[model samples]
Each structure stands twice: as structure tokens, then as C-alpha cells.
Target: MPIYNKLVRDRIPEVIEKTGKKFHATVLSQDVYIEELKKKSFEELEEYIAAETGAEALEELADMFEILHAFAAVHGSTIQGVEKIRKEKEQKRGGFNERIFLVDVED
Candidate 1:
């Protein structure tokens, strides 16, 4: 059996069981869960970057979306709350829609 020491989605164990595969998993402590979430986010981001097709990119983005929701819940907030903050920041500064790149800023 291949060893996977990383975090997985909640239903992964059930999925594996359906394939008659025995696996080992443990519930992470609060601190460890948070750390794993951060790590998972990076993993998902890397997958997204490597996606060659639009559908594959979308699938990876959905995984990242799920991770974001889990992160919000762990921090005692909802996706709506995070969106609100995002909107506020967008209104104050701006968004990436312009595709502007800053090469240098001299004093």
C-alpha cells in the first residue's frame, strides 16, 4: 500500500473502503488541522497551476474552494464573511482585473 501522510477530504476513507482498501487515518488536533489546511491550500494551488485544461483547472479550483470553506469554519467565520472582507478591500484599493504589473517604484 502506498503511504500517504497528508490530509484528505472527509469522504476519502469511505471512498477507499468501497474499493476494499484498508487505510489508516486519524483526526487531527485543532492546531494540526489548521496547519494541514494551510499545507493543503498550497498543494491545491500547485495543482491548479499545473492544470493544462480548463476543466482540470476548474476541478482544482473547486478543491481549493472546499479548502477555503473549511478554513473559514475553523476560524469561526463563514464564506460570506470572507467575501465581505474581500469586497471591502476591493473597493478600497482595487482588484486584479486590470492586469497591471508594477515593475518598479522609486522614492
Candidate 2:
């Protein structure tokens, strides 16, 4: 009966029940949900950074991707809308594909 007071995916309870494990979970209020999602995003990012193998990294990245979608919805936008903004920024300022590292500029 370990305690895990954190946000989880919607199907987690069902998955736990199939294992005959009883757990208690509460629904977060709108404000709290947003806050928790932010926390979860950081958690996922840390896991992604710690991943050693390519497959493990991709798995962590997928988790972060899910969090990104949740964030977009919480902010009243869809993933498509986010992608559109990203493309516009890319067109204006370009993306990281060039791997350019900027040094200090002269004053």
C-alpha cells in the first residue's frame, strides 16, 4: 500500500483494479488540474533527460507529448493550433535543425 499522491493517466485505476489492487484517487479541480499538469510536465521532462537508450527516450518523449496535448487543451487550444503557431515561428525565426550555437555578442 505505497502512497502515490500524484496525477495519473485516466485508465490507471482500471489497470490497477485488474491486478486486484485497491487504490484511492481524487479528481482535481480545474485550477489544481492545471497546476498538477505543469508538475507532471516537469516530471516527464526529467525522465526524458535521464533516459539512456533510444527506445526509453522515445517512451519518455511520448509521455511528454501527452502532457503537451493536455496543456494545450487546458489553455483552450488544440494540438493543431499549437503546431500552427510553431510553424509560424519557424517560418519567421527558423527552427533548431541547423544546430547553431550562438556565442556572446559584442556590446
Candidate 3:
């Protein structure tokens, strides 16, 4: 029955322990989680914009995906669940396969 589950990353867990906060605690507050996700996204965006290497951009993008996944989890959904819905919609309507029309963008 703990609030705010601990998200461990390197020395974070140890640091939190020293600070007397419970590690791996369950997150029960929706508002708190939303704010946390927003902060995470902002931090990731900063790094993405400051990145000097192509690999860094990819890493930042991965971080963005993680943030999205966490947001879905907070709302009781998984990434797979989203994909299933997307696939169903595509099947019912049209997917990239049906978009035969193509044009060069840079031209």
C-alpha cells in the first residue's frame, strides 16, 4: 500500500534509499504521475535538442518511447494494446499498403 513506485535507474535507487524514500513503491496518484511524465519528457527533449551525435538522437528517441510506455501503463494500457487497436483500424479502413500514391518530398 505504498504511493509512487520506485523507478530505478543506476544510482537513483541507492540515492532514494539514502534519502529515506521507499524503493519500487507502487504509484497510486494519477496527478503526480502525470507531472512526473511531463518533467521526464521535457528533460528528454532538452537532451535530444542538445545532442551532437546521431546515436544520441536515437537514445533520446528511445527515452521518449519509454515515457510514452509509462504514460500508457499509468492509464492501465500497454503498448501492445495500442498496436492492436491501430491494426484493427487499419484493417477496417486503410493502411500504408493502400496508399499507393507517392511523391518526392524534397523535389
Off by over 4 Å in 2: none
Best by lDDT: 1
Candidate 2 residue pairs in backbone clash: none
lDDT of 2 by residue, 1-107 (tens): 79989999999999999999888999999999999999999999999999999999999999999999999999999999999999999999999999999998999
Clashes of 1: 0
Give me the overall lDDT of model 3: 0.76
* Candidate 3: C-alpha RMSD after superposition: 7.9
The whole-model C-alpha lDDT of candidate 2 against the native structure comes to 0.96
Lowest lDDT block of 10, candidate 3: 1-10
Given candidate 1, what's the lDDT at residue 24?
92
TM-score, one value per model = 0.97, 0.96, 0.55
Whole-model Cα lDDT per candidate? 0.96, 0.96, 0.76
Clashes of each: 0, 0, 2
Off by over 4 Å in 1: none
**Number of colliding residue pairs in model 2:** 0
